[model samples]
Target: MIITRAKEYCIKILSSSNCKKLPFHNLSHTQEVVEHAALIAKETSIDSEETEPIIIAAWFHDTGHSKTYFGHEEVSKELANEYLTSVGYDTKKIKIVLSCIDATKMPQHPSNLHAKVLCDADLFHIGTELFFCKKLLLRREWELEKIKTYSDKEWHKINLAFLEKHKFKTDYGQTVLEDMKLKNLEKVKTILSFY
Candidate 1:
């Protein structure tokens, strides 16, 4: 199907990139998001039509990281638009994919189920067993990119605030991930105690 083609295209594009600068948002991260998106979509029982754009959006979501460090979502849209249009993807559907990608921008505001799924999938790590591991990678990437640097204590405080502020949008996320995220938050707090 076209979704498979889109996957191949995205894989090729990402593989061809010199992704050394992208410690976190690289192919591994993209693949995780795609898998999470697909799993979330399936658990929600969304039909293929909905799943298509969600999967497509997942694959292309972080592709902009190959181009720029910040505001990559817009470049993601341009790349998705160019590729989808070349493949003669339905305009309405392409819009859906782009919107899904946009939904992942921080302080994410996802209006639709597809966008919600994509957003949750994009951040699936926050609720997983590896939040700290992922967090370390993200922190390193941020330092490498000169976005910001924080001592472990400072970072833990910031992470605690973030975990407190963040909420999962999807019902599956709220039900399945929320508990783990809360657990992670408490763990963060516990770690901060030593600092």
Candidate 2:
């Protein structure tokens, strides 16, 4: 029931909250990550207890974006903590959820199975057909935030670097998602050839 409430809370906070700035990390992305998190948890065959926190974490993971551009993970933790505590969630489970949220940060360092699942789920799009569409949204978001402006070629090059350096930390991600990731890499290379 808490998981359902967490999802509802995510939708409410993200939709009605001052999240206009988050083009990429908005509700859709959070929902997709939650979906992927559940799938990865089942695929990896973790216990139901462990799966619950990961799902809640996924729902709240990028919520920090509603508050700040950088360090959203910390903000997300604050939001999760506030809600979970008000609902009297277990301290241990809340810790796991916070850790999983932190694990979604870039250059992820997941110390446990729950973290690994959340991390992979957060980046799950990079290995799916949705990558190109999602990448454009992220690029637009970055440009909107004025984080860094990149020419088309420059963006492709950066994506190449990120794709090269990024490895799926979970075995299911490494094996199941790796195939499409390689294909996406090739696609990016081909697109880059035109520039």
Candidate 3:
């Protein structure tokens, strides 16, 4: 029920006034992440008592992308708080939601179960077939911002570096997601060597 309601809210929010600035951080991405979170919750030993907050956090995780502002995880948290409060979501749950969203920042080290769930779900595509598509979306987003553009080789190098340094901290993440992630990393390495 909470997931359904949050999904509805996410669709409505992305469809309304918040449509312009978010090229990639739009409703579909939110939906995908929420679905990923729910899957992780079910597949792992995570408490269902905490599922509502994680789902809510996933729904609002990128709401700040609708803003002209950049790197808006903090702004995402604020929007989540306001929206959750306005809709009479439980205050304690809202706090957990906000914290989960905030835990997705670039230098993230999620300190709790909810935060770990959000972090892993937000990155769930890293091992999927859509990994390249997600990477392109991010690159295009950077291009839109007039940030430095990356060549194919440069991008692969950067991605490889990231994969080399990154490790899944949660047991759920390690057990369920790590092998595919490593496979994806190897694929990237192959593609880079070919370039």
lDDT of 2 by residue, 1-195 (tens): 999999999898889765655678888888889999999999999888889999999999988877788999999999999999999999999999999999888889998889999999999999999899999999999988889999999999999989988999898899999999999999999999998
Predicted candidate 3 versus true structure: per-residue lDDT over 1-195, tens digit per residue: 766776686677677745445566777777788888888877766788878899889988887776644677887788777777888888989888988888888767787888888888888888677788888887777777787698989988988888788776567778878988899899998998787
| Model 2: ten consecutive residues of lowest lDDT | 16-25
**What TM-score should be assigned to candidate 1?**
0.97
lDDT (C-alpha, whole model) for all candidates: 0.91, 0.91, 0.80
TM-score of 2: 0.96
Clashing pairs in 1: none
lDDT score at residue 152, model 3, on the 0-100 scale:
86
Which candidate ranks first by TM-score, i.e. highest? 1
lDDT of 2 at 57: 98
Residue 149, candidate 2: how far off, in angstroms?
Answer: 1.9
> What is residue 165's positional error in candidate 2, in angstroms?
0.4
Q: Arrange candidates, best lDDT first.
A: 2, 1, 3
Tens digits of per-residue lDDT for model 1, 26-120: 88888999999999999889987889999999999988877887999998999999999998999999989999999999989998999999999
Candidate 3 lDDT (Cα, whole model)? 0.80
